[model samples]
Target: MQAWQGIDEFVSVVEQGSFTKAGQQLQVSTAHVSRSINALEKRLAVKLLHRSTRQVSTTATGQIYYQQCRQLLDGLLDANRTVNQLNTTPSGLIKITAPIYYGERIIAPLFNRLLQQYPDIELDLQLSNHNVELISEGFDLAIRLGSLADSSLMARRIGSRHFDVVASKSYFARCGQPHTIDELNQHNCLRGISDHWHFDVDGRRKDLRIHGSWRCNSGLAVARAAMDGIGIAQLPHYYTDNAVEDGRLMRVLEQHRPHSEGIWAVYPQNRHLSTKLRVVIDFLAAELGEQR
Candidate 1:
């Protein structure tokens, strides 16, 4: 604890550029801050900062020490924020981003429900298909599906995404059914995978390069194309849940149905997460789990 106090004083002096300013900010006398830093230097046996008339400068060793000390202090401050947030009501605008199709069909409803339950919470939702940086773009959270490319963010799995290749009943009636992965090459495919399809066989994953004239970036568009007898499309279970149940679309190569990945609520890596974000994440996990 005494070491921490010493570190605090040292960091304050460096940031404020003067012992007097640092002492004022810490609500202590200049002499006390100087004494704390001196004690720290004696304990560490290293000169941390070079003092001058106008400002204090850090040596290479000081830079390293400052970084470590800043990390510790920031961690402590973050913990305090978390504790305070737990006791405080969540009433701030939380910015969230999600893919377009999922945002409209899945995320939007859940977000609306959250908003209803916590009227104090304000939501700024961005619906797009492009991947964006969570920290640099300043999003509080993001709902992502499939594989996570960036390992830096923290991800909490909310649900599983099951995928199947399907075509409209009319399309199947014309081109026939595909019983094997190889048979898919004989028919017109919707080609949503950027000219490829993934499959699972005997507990192993496989990627099969596919070809088609109709290419689409939108899942809904691909589904719509398949429904119009344009081609077969590989789509997530949620996208074709109602249609598949209603016999609007027919599933093909059931054994080749791709392995289900997870749905995740992701956020930037933080030493401590806010209460509002944690509650919402837990709520989403619980709600989506129940839905499954």
Candidate 2:
């Protein structure tokens, strides 16, 4: 440990740009910080710093040394955290983000049950339709729906959902049920956030560019319009499932039903997850039904 004694102090001095700041951060005297770094340099037999009146900088060798030291320090921190987390229960303020509708309808209810079980765990959940930067925005987790694009964060599939091409039974009675993909263009389609609707043509996925008199960004609103006999709308299962079951809306284009997309819980890349995040994600994966 002798060689490691001043290693951290040296890293802090280089990173913090001054011995005084490093000492303040480490809660040691500036003199002690300087002495330890000087001792490390002597022990290593290398000049590690380029010191001036106003600033302290790393030498070329020091930069390489700093990189290695940083990895070692980070590894040590992660090891300590892992050991501590192992002994502890899932208790912490969990900050997360999810889509507005899903958060209100699904995540909120499921997390409420989790709160009932782990009363010590606190929640700071933000509901939004927009994508947020997890690390920069300080979110511990995110519940994202649909196929994810290439990203740096780690993701676990919790569930899946599909679009139900649906309309009111009355509307189907008047217009007649269209049986094929090309027939969709002949009908009045209620649009959602995207005018492009997705479908499964044979085994491959296809996007249907649609147009209509009734259009809205919210799936709930789009479903409501379909119920009111406005037009056929492709709505998410979560929004339309109850109505479909209750006979308020009739599912059309059963053969062209788009492939179910995955629901995911994403988090920052860490060596190991804290118990709170792990348990919640597991609960979601187990409790949230698949292949909707």
Candidate 3:
């Protein structure tokens, strides 16, 4: 094989830590990966990798080589992508994560349409409420809600996540409505996983601790409980919009409703942005930004 060919295999082995995994990444056999790396080392007359049974680490020389080669390889990928983007349609596998409710309600449908448009494209969708580390976990993108704190990751606001405090008409008729944030002290506020309710009070954000006879983790479940006149619940607009419009629920304390939270598409900053990542992020911004 050409000397230049093993650069990718060697880098993959270094990144993946095992010849087997490197081969899997490069779509080759472990024996082939081992032989190519050995050949590359033989040609260079240098020991690049310190290999052992459990894992592999780079030699001192190898570490420096890796840093330089990684940049070159990443640049080559970008150059290839630039050329291929003009010559071919966008197509690749994208691994993504999003909150379960929003993923099911919004993101899933948009991706369904995107898939129909580009049948060659593939997606591995992971939906959960927890924060995911994109780089360590090998995810291509993440759809995050609320404020962003991880400066190491890059983000783009795709849309807004508006929230409201709402209750069933019967519940309010029996208990009474709260006109201000302080009035919630006497009301049954069905809490989600978070005990603190957020609001914009006098141009500043406030976190008011709320309680009820009932509490759950799901916003959707809390919204349902409030619909049964159990108590008032704070929920994202996506959950309460249809109910409020149809009179199943009535919004209260609109003046105290916090500014709509940001819906963001986030990815690791250090990694090269591939064409697949570009298409997904651009698609999200265009498709969801219209909702703002």
lDDT of 3 by residue, 199-221 (tens): 99999989999978999889889
Better of 1 and 2 by lDDT: 2
Whole-model Cα lDDT of every candidate shown, in order: 0.87, 0.91, 0.89
Clash count per candidate: 0, 0, 0
> What lDDT is obtained when candidate 3 is compared to the true structure?
0.89
> Which parts of model 2 have CA positions greater than 4 angstroms off?
1-86, 289-291
RMSD of model 1 against the true structure: 4.0
For model 2 the local lDDT of residue 53 reads 85
Residue pairs with clashing backbones, model 2: none
> How would you encode candidate 2's per-residue C-alpha lDDT over 161-254 as one tens digit per residue?
8888999999998888889878888889999889898888888899989878888888889989999999999988998989989999999888
Give Cα distance to truth, residue 148, candidate 3, Å.
2.1
Task: Give me candidate 1's TM-score against the actual structure.
Answer: 0.75
Give the poorly placed runs of model 1, Cα more than 4 Å off. 1-5, 38-67, 131-140, 147-157, 168-176, 209-218, 224-231, 262-275, 289-292
- Clash pairs, candidate 3, are none
